[model samples]
Each structure stands twice: as structure tokens, then as C-alpha cells.
Target: MKIIKYLLNSTCLLLIFSINPIRAQVTIGSDIEPRNGTILDIKQNSNTGHNPNAEGGLGLPRVRLVNPNTLTIDSDTEKSKYIGVTVYNTGNAGVPEGLYFWDGNTWRLSVSVSSYGNDGQFLKSDGKGSFDWSTFVMPDYKYHRPTQISVLKSANVKPESYSYQRLTDGGTGSFGGATPSAAFEYLYSDELNILSETANEKYLFIGIAATTRTKTINNNVPRTSYWQIVGIDIDLTDKNGLNVRTLQKNQRLYKTAGGSDLRSYVDLFTIVPITGVGKGSYTLKIKVYNVENTFSRNTGSEGGNFVTTETRFYDINLVDINFILYEDD
Candidate 1:
């Protein structure tokens, strides 16, 4: 029975050798001697005498430790003795129960860490073997952080009308997406969803509309205030007087001359914090004023109502109004 001298601590071997001849090689686990081109080979099992591949599997020694993996570390003597030691875990849920080893400092797992998740999903562990695999929570999604949400809305009105009839094509909906929401309606006003109508949250409102009209004016200064564009305003059912946003300070002329065709747009935006008096759903409203058929004639009075032709706050046609509401904070 030959053995690798390095593996055995025994000193009973003889050193007899022929003159100028090489030493014989060592072989183990086989009595027929190792095959050519082999140095130290491990083959058949010692107890069963069958080849290693034909048996159940190769086996290694397992050491049972006393109170393993406490927050208090083990002593150096225990660390050195258990350095490459494999054990069946009777404790420590953070590691696998099948195979764990002490790599001189900590215990390592021999199992897999990728078997719990699928595509578009990731494994979230609680620093233990337990994991939760779910869909990725995107920051830009509406359910996540403060995202820019756009509502595709439109309203139609005649020349000089205060009633802003919400337009509905039976196919379009709020949020500018394909998904139709019942909260937005053509016959009813739009219920702007701004996270929550509660306090401590801030909101921003911006509105833009294109106006189409014609006016007649001779002097550029002796004003023709027929085709007028005013600021956009919002009305809160719970809080009045512009808490979330009241009106924009924008005014323009859609017509300036006798045959001058006017095509203009009105843009208005404002920032509002909800720490004020309003605490309910927000409704987008338009601002209207009664402009007496007054011409700003720099003749006698400073921009006074000179020519009184007709007096009425008639409605004007708004091609489309784009209302954008988002969280400022």
C-alpha cells in the first residue's frame, strides 16, 4: 500500500534505493497501480471498492459547531480549525440549510441566488434567505414620485361667452393617454387629479388657448378692445379666491384693424401651495370681463371708453385649451 508522503505524518518508511535510480511514485485507492501519465490519483472508494463515479457521490467530513454565527465572532483558534470546514446548518436563517462553510472569517453559501426572479422583476431579500420577487417600481410612474401628468382637455365657446363647455369627441380622454377616464367629461367639468386634495402639498397650473377672431381699428394706439385675450383662472370648490391658482395676467388682441384677421394664443401659468384655504378638488375655470364697446382713443381722456357701439361680454371661440397641472414640490 503506497501513499503520498506529504499526506501522511508517519516516519516509518524505508529510504532504500538503487544507485543512480529514481524514486518510485505513490498511488492510492487502487491496487493495480496508477495508469500512465498520472501522478497522485484518487479513484475507487475505500469501503465499497467501487469506482467513485459509480457510487452515490464523493463525501466529505462535516463539523458540528457550538453556537455558530453569533454577532460575537469566534476566537482565532476556532477560526483556524474551521477554516474550510463544511457543516449542515442547524441555525442561521440568513444562510442555506444544506451547505455552509467557514472561510476563516464568515460562513459562505453554496446555493444559488438567481433562481427567485424573472425578467422585469428583481429579488428583494431581507438580509436573509427569504426574498420577494416583484415588478420594478419605476420612479417616473404615476404611482411613484412626483411625475409630470398631462391632461388632454379641450373646451369650445362662442364669441364672448363665460360658460366654458368642455369638449368631448367620445374618443379622447384625460391625461392625454388612450385610457379613457370617467372623471373627465364633455358635458361636465374636468376633475383634475393632483395626487390628493389634502393639505401640505403644492401644485402648479398652466393654461394655453388659441383664439380666432377679426377686428377693425384705425390707430394703433386709439385702441380696439373687441378681440381681447385675458388670463386663465382656476376655481376651487372648497376654497375660493385663487388658492391653488386664480387668474393669469395676460391680455392680447386677436383683431386690430377693419379687415385685419387675427390669430393669437393665450398662455398663462402660476404656482400655488396648498397650505392655504382650499382643500378640495380643483376645477379649471376661465376669466371673463365686460368690455364696453370702448376705444382707447388718446384724444381727450387717457384710454377711456369713447365710442359706445354695443355693450356685452359675448363669448369667443377657443380653438383648443391645453391645461397642464403638476406638483411643484
Candidate 2:
């Protein structure tokens, strides 16, 4: 009887062990796209008069998880159009992780971290500007400076002498604004200046501005910075995409400021950079927004003109011309 009892007991223990299950807490990594849902409660209660736009329009919610199980939104607005997600963890063990949003063309890192109580609802923004989510992350605005720092590293040109042809919208009669407050501002770097190979001559001119390329300066920080084009070269491409007959080396001041990415400019034939510098001394024809359906050419008819009118020729130094370069990655 004792032997039989021992066998039954052992069998029962084995059965219990086999039926036991292990629970795996999912650490939603960067790829998980959250679903978009309206935070009706916040919307109805918030004081901000602006109606927030909805988040996560694409197949997946625009939000992504960056750190393991750490969800953050990086904003302080109590009610704003924001990326939303659903999760299983709640209560004391459910510390909210950082959340990220994917802007249509690119992924925007969320600026805040949210917490879900035992009820599984995200708490409102924490009142710090850091948590504000109303302004969507713009990959275009990711970096205000140039991405290629190597290009400017060796350049020792004096200020005011170095100039570039800034590109903007031809329609606006000026540069476009990325924000409402800073409309039509120049987008070039004030710290940069360039001299043309040719100067003090009667010829069309172009300007080349400093451009920067960047690498991760600090990786431990979660906030993302970007490589930006920042400035432009003074030369213009004609209707046929050819540069105009202007001297290969001339200078022009890029006076317009503010606004990133999209800007305006005039047609090729008319001289630009009209207002900023001394008359006949500087004019900006090319802008950042010169890209589009309009045909490009090497002549003014095609929105092309001389980048410079100076008598100095750059043929000898052409071999070492640094058109493009990057910093150490």
C-alpha cells in the first residue's frame, strides 16, 4: 500500500508541474505601431481652445516604443492631438514607457512618457512643456545646421565675404515660414561666409554657403538630432539645368532668414537678393524652394545664371574643389 501511494503522489506532482504556465511580459520595442484612439475624456475636459488633430492615420498607430517597456510622449500639454496606445500592464508595475510617433514620411520620437493606472487609462500630460505633443515632429526640422561638418571644418574664409544663393518660393516673393511667428526668415548660417574664385568684374554671380553633415555626438541621450543641409551654394542652375554664364566666382549676400526647407525665389532673368545688400553688390535669385516642376537650365531662361562674375578663374583648383564632404562618423 505504501509503494502504491508513493507512485500516485509522484504522478500527481508531475502532472501539476507539466500544467504550470510561464507568463512573458511583452517589451514593445521600436517597431510596434500603436493604434489611434480619441482620448475623449481629455478632449472634453481640457482648456486649450484649439482642436487637436487625430493621431495614427496609417494602417498602424503612428506611435512606436523606443526603450524596452518604457513608454513616453515627451509633452506637457494636458489635451493635444497625440499618439495613443493600449497596453496590458497596469498599476505599480506599470510604469509608462516612452512612446514615439511616425510622421508620414518619417518616424518622430515621442516627447513624453505616459502612465496607465490599474484602470488602463493614460494619465494626462504632466504640465511640463517637455510633454507637449501638439506640434508634430518634422524630420525636415530635425537639424537646424548642416549634416556635413567636414565641409566647413577647413574653411577659414572671413565673414560677409562668403555668401550663398538661398532658395525659396518664387510665388511668395520671399522665403516661406515653417512657423507662424518667424515668417520669411533667411535659412543660411550666420556664422558661415564664402568668397568666390572671381570677384570685381561685370558678370553674373553665384554664391556657395556653408553646409554641415553631423554624426551622433552623444548616443546615450534619447532625444534625436539630425543632419541638415542648412546653407546653399550661390550658383544657379538654368532652365536646361546648366549654370549661367556668370563668373565661376562671385559673391552675393543671403539676407532672408527663418523658415526651413521650403522657401521662394524669382524667375531666372530678374536679378534677386534685391533688398538686403548694397544695390548691385548682392542679390539672391536662388532659394531653398527652387525645386519643382519648373524646368532648370544653365541660362537665365531656365532659372539658371552665373554663380559669380569675378575675373578670377577656378580651373587650376578644380582638381581639389570640395563640392561635398562629411565629418568622421
Task: Say which candidate scores most in lDDT.
Answer: 1
Number of backbone clashes in candidate 2: 81
Residue-level lDDT tens digits of model 1 in 204-308: 544545442222233123244344434444454333434454533556544443333333454445554444433455555544332222223223453323222
Error of 2 at 113 (Å): 96
Candidate 2 Cα deviation (angstroms), residue 97: 97
Candidate number achieving the greatest TM-score relative to the actual structure: 1
